[model samples]
Target: MERKQTAELTNLVMVYDDNGNVLVEEKVGSNYRGLIFPGGHVEPGEAFVDSAIREIQEETGLNIKNVKLCGVKNWVEFDGSRYIVFLYKTNKFSGELTSSDEGRVFWMPLEKLRKAENKLWHMDQMLELSCGNTYSELYFNRNDSAIKPILK
Candidate 1:
């Protein structure tokens, strides 16, 4: 029997301020629309952390450093391929905030963001994982009905 392989790799970074706020991107033109962290797919032969940093800069115009790897989210597709998203967090960054074609980037209070209705599905779980409160997020696709997230 042959083993399945990971088909896609991505990252999600939580950039927070000292004032209890987190940087967010209000995604506009994608199926996974809504508020989300600044991140993107990892390029071939590129480092994971480097990808995270590069994505942040591209999406939010922030130069982040000392990013801490908090956790990961992963799931298997119907085609038997897996997708993995590395979660990271960092309070260290410097740049004039700007928005890109990806979304409108802005800062929101953590508490306020928690209560926002426009957040993407599983944003809460992703936040927990990115904050180191959880080790990983395992997604289950059940009978093509709904996607269930299990935090570990």
Candidate 2:
């Protein structure tokens, strides 16, 4: 028997350095690495903006002053699971970043992130949008799924 399709929303965060570079992290409890962002699942009836702010603060220890929606990505796959992501960008934050459950955080050059191990798959697109100063909604069909946006 096949599983029924279910839709879910994930709040994704991309933290950048003062120079506007993406922060990458080492994988916790696994050898695999990928670009790390401070984000997680959105609770039911939970607003996206609130979720983004809460997730960021919880994961990164930073309180974002200005949060903006930059993208929304939707994915459907053979497994009967559908994933939707609400993307937000914030350039202003307070407090220093600390170690978290996700992993250690470090700033990586946006221009050459694709080659980085544990590199988030969509980084390139996110960096581009960051440059353009626009928020975007991206759609995907599951081949493999990841929401982190890293630069190429």
Candidate 3:
């Protein structure tokens, strides 16, 4: 018999600077690699926005404000576990970028992220969804490689 679907919460933040460059991290995790935004799991009982802020600070050493919930993404693992991600974007931040064992953080042009050499996961879709005006959600069936937008 198939196992029941279990839900898990996570977060992803797109930090942009005054120069229009977005902060990308080279992930050290085995499951994911290459250039990606700086974010991670929300701590237990923490407010979603607070979690975003905390993850941003921990991963990038930046205190960010104007934390906007721009989008959401759902990834259904092969084991029937669901990972829900809250996507945030912010231009208002302070402090120097610091390195973390999670990844090396740096600023890069949006176009550079789109280039062929970059190994970001779903870079085009992710960029579009995060920059979208309205809040959105996307579901990806990791087992089958199927994806579609979802309603809240």
Best by TM-score: 1
- Top candidate when judged by lDDT against the true structure: 1
Runs in model 1 lying further than 4 Å from the true structure: 30-32, 142-152
Residue runs of model 2 more than 4 Å from their true location after superposition: 1-5, 29-31, 112-117, 133-135, 143-152
lDDT of 3 by residue, 10-45 (tens): 888999977769998888666667888988887788
TM-scores, all candidates, are 0.89, 0.73, 0.86
The lDDT of model 1 is: 0.85
Residue lDDT tens for model 1, 1-152: 86757579999899999999999999887466799888999999999999999999999889999999887777767877778888899999999999999889999999898889889857887876776555466475533635555556
List clashing residue pairs in candidate 1: none
At residue 150, what lDDT does model 2 achieve? Answer: 30
Candidate 2: tens digits of C-alpha lDDT, residues 45-115? 99888888887777778888677776676777667687877767777878877758777766667666656
Q: lDDT (0-100) at residue 35 of candidate 3?
A: 82
Q: Kindly indicate the candidate among 1 and 3 with the higher lDDT.
A: 1
